[model samples]
Target: MSEADGIVYSDVKFTRTKRNTRGTTSSEAEPTYSEVRILKTHPSTELPGSQQHPVSNGGSKVTPERVVIVVLSALLAAAVIALGFTSLDNMHTKQSFQTLRDELEAVKRNLTERHCEVKSYNTVQQTSPQPPVVKENDPCLKCERGWEQDGRQCYYFSIDLLTWSESRDKCRQKGGDLVQIDSRDEQTFLELKVREKMKNDGDMFWIGLTDSEKEGTWLWVNGSPLNERLTFWSASGPDNWAVYNPDGEDCVMMGKKAGAPDLKCWFDEFCKYTRRSICEKPAETGHFTLQCV
Candidate 1:
């Protein structure tokens, strides 16, 4: 193989022997040698005046282009895997957040329903005595289903018989206190209502007035002094009667009389005596809604 002319030459030899006329083989033979030169161009090398061709190494060698492509492919596959994992994690996070939000909303609603009037029922409102502010004809007044609405007040006449303390407890459970007769009209309203519902002459309803703190100075359940002008003691008297038991008559009750004058129904009695009683609360205003139990 010559690089200058891009030719490849090879030598091959052949041997010949002279035969006798009678076709007998001769033992002595003379070998003749001849020089033969054949010119061929190499398939892989470039000729002097022709274009150059690429060399091949049986596909064993790696090129720069192939190395770059392999590296890029591996990087792309890794990126795709990472992206899939990130997307899955985000989906789980979103689902967890939504579940927590729903739980919070349910708890908030339950709190609102159960605690609507708890504070109002526990705290007593102290106010000076004044003329009754009636709103019986107002459009915004609202009350519970079984309660009677008068002016801005709702009254619940309980049928269950309980002691004075027990009756106040029951009223507090219903989001109210015992009825506070603040005016002549209120006393008259209660008198007429009790008269109609009386089962017999002994039937009566307990009022909120009490004189247990002192012998003579009476106070309402809300710690307010009884009004001197609004006295409704029975015609017979409060008397602080103690004939039945030793505790004396400290609590008051209102009973129906066959021909008693209006607002003349109140009587001082033993606090341990069980009787039907009345409860009273202000009507719900526009600011907040109260769910009475």
Candidate 2:
């Protein structure tokens, strides 16, 4: 190949032998040589492809299309795995909530059924032969549920402890105040009830009377002066032997003795101490008749 006139030219040689009339061929007698030049330039290298790209893994080049497919497949697999776990977690949470709802429904059903049943077959309220006319001294009245009836009053004994003021507030909420003993009969009745409630031991409880505002000048919830004539005090009672006795022993309390079933169980206590309470209020008409529960 050569370059001439701003164009590339190629030369090719050829040999030819002359044929004899006698049908004899001689290669050594005649030989011919010819030169041919290519006018157009020819390609010497291969062309690149648009349909594919090369990828290598230390072996042979691979197609870019195949590599993309593999990457897409891996991503798809990871997405599928993540979705599977998320869906499973959601299902578990749904199941847990369903179980809780079922348990709550079951508890509600049990409570509804229990509320339908009464305490006992023999438990029944008896209306008086006629509505008893209430009076001031010896009134005939009725009590409410969880209260005891005595003459014209309704009394309630607390099972929990509260400070004297707290107990008074609670009693007032129930339409009463801590008990105020008016007579020895009332005191005896209260003592018997207390003994019945305490079974084996004695418990301290608060009353309405207090000397808190003014020392020694005790008063009742009705603002009545203490009935100094009719009183119950044990041996060395009202001694005010508390820690800050004379000053802190402002609230009145009742303490029972195992052997002493007397009204002399009264004592002075700190108004801040937590203790049971006795509440009393005037009975209402058509209220429940008191019975031992």
Candidate 3:
């Protein structure tokens, strides 16, 4: 038998028995055959319900649970990488902004400092001393007693208490005459000075303007005519010798008090009243030229 048949026969057996009947005389020889069948089951080496075919161990045989876990782990790793990049970007942006802000602050501070420095320099420049433009000429002349030098002219505030004619003569003796106010500023200045220095109350002061030498012809001691519009005379003033002096009224005198009236007389005899006087000469022009030279 083949090896496969032998293995099968080894698990099975057959048995048989024979019986003889009497009455069959003469040599009743009865023959009987017996056969016996036996079945035997063998124990297999593998356990019950075990796989009949070998299973392959390839990567395709992975379990569902293991696949889900691997996918989740990969997703988690990607999330972490993205978060790291975002954090780095944020940090870089913050640093750049901080640097810009610091630079701006430094620029502002420098500008402020420069502005202050310029202002200080300008202030110093303004305060520095500058030279005078006018030159000194003849030393100021000293006026005689009762006379004072004002500007380039000598002025006398008379206290002599003399008649109009005597006053005129006195001014001539001093090489000057009654004062003439050439400008409003000069007039105001002289008025203030005279008021401050006056001693007599009811006295009248002689000014350079007069119509005395001729009727209605007012002239200054310096040979300049009085400007009728500029004369500070009370209404209807200079009406001296009303009948005999129809015109020839000359000589002007101002009252000592504020709002005092002006008086004009043809004769020097009326000058006895105390009055403030002013004298003037052409302003010295040589000094200005010498300064330029």
Candidate 4:
């Protein structure tokens, strides 16, 4: 409009105009600028005393609280490690004890088996075999020359003889004594051997029967006394005195001839007779023919 429309305006008037921007169109007036009054501000008021300490933004900065937490965590970790070691040690100790117990049980089982085997062997040895006796003339006979084994008994025939005491002593030296008959089977066996094998010579041979050590009490040299029931003493034989002096008759002789069994008294001075005499012993239980060491 013409300058102030012919009248001078005293108050300031503001006019606003708008302009189009790149993609926006505007149809408005521009705003007028005006002066703004600011109230007076007292000199900046400072904190009353010392300056505040600065704060840092470093991400890794350590604070007192954080240090305390870290220390506590370290203690926890140490406790955990100690507990683990204790458990492992306890397990190891238990394993060692179990191993020792197992070994002891195994040893006990082995010992029991060995004892059983020994008992079985002993039982078998008690039930084996034995040997037999043979006639003197038989090739299998192991008796002294001119001797015969009948059943369990052995007999001999004498040609050159001596006093009964001498013959008895000689028989004892060869691992035997003059024959002593104890059982019916033994007596029968001896009588048969004499009948079948003796020479017809009239000489009498000493038997094991003797009363020398104690008169009237017959005892075999082997220390077994003759039982009265098994004796071959002739009737009224062994009378305290005989063709010899009053010293009780101590020895007995049996002749090959029937009815010639007699008790004889002899002096110890005649103990060196060179007569064939019978030597007898109970056959050992097993393998009677084989000699035992």
Candidate 4 per-residue lDDT, tens place, 159-229, comes to: 54666666665666655678876666555555555545456644445677777777667777788877876
Query: Model 4, residue 213: what's the lDDT?
Result: 78
Instruction: Name the runs in model 1 displaced over 4 angstroms.
Output: 1-139, 285-293
lDDT of the structure predicted as candidate 1 = 0.78
Q: What are the per-model C-alpha RMSD values against the true structure?
A: 21.1, 19.7, 27.0, 24.5
Q: After aligning candidate 2 to the native by TM-score, how far in Å is the CA of 88 from where it should be?
A: 99
Model 3 alpha-carbon drift over 4 Å, by segment: 1-146, 199-201, 241-249, 259-293
Supply every candidate's count of residue pairs whose N, Cα or C atoms clash at under 3 angstroms.
0, 0, 28, 7
Per-residue lDDT for 282 in model 1? 83
Tens-digit lDDT track of model 2 for 81-104: 999999999999998998999899
> Residue 47 in model 2: shift from native, Å?
99
Write one digit per residue (lDDT tens) for candidate 3, span 1-293.
34443233322233333333563435434444444444445668999888898777665767999999999999999999999999999999998998999899768645533432112334444564342233354332233445554545657777666655667777777666667776654565566666666665555567767666676687877788877766655555666644454443456766545544232221221433444454443333222221211
Candidate lDDT values, in order? 0.78, 0.74, 0.56, 0.55
* lDDT, model 4, position 174: 51
lDDT of 3 at 270: 42
Candidate 4 global TM-score: 0.39
- TM-score (C-alpha) between model 2 and the true structure: 0.50
171: Cα error in model 1, Å: 0.5
Q: How far is candidate 1 from the true structure (C-alpha RMSD, Å)?
A: 21.1
Give the Cα error of residue 13 in candidate 4, in Å.
99
TM-score on alpha carbons, each prediction:
0.50, 0.50, 0.40, 0.39
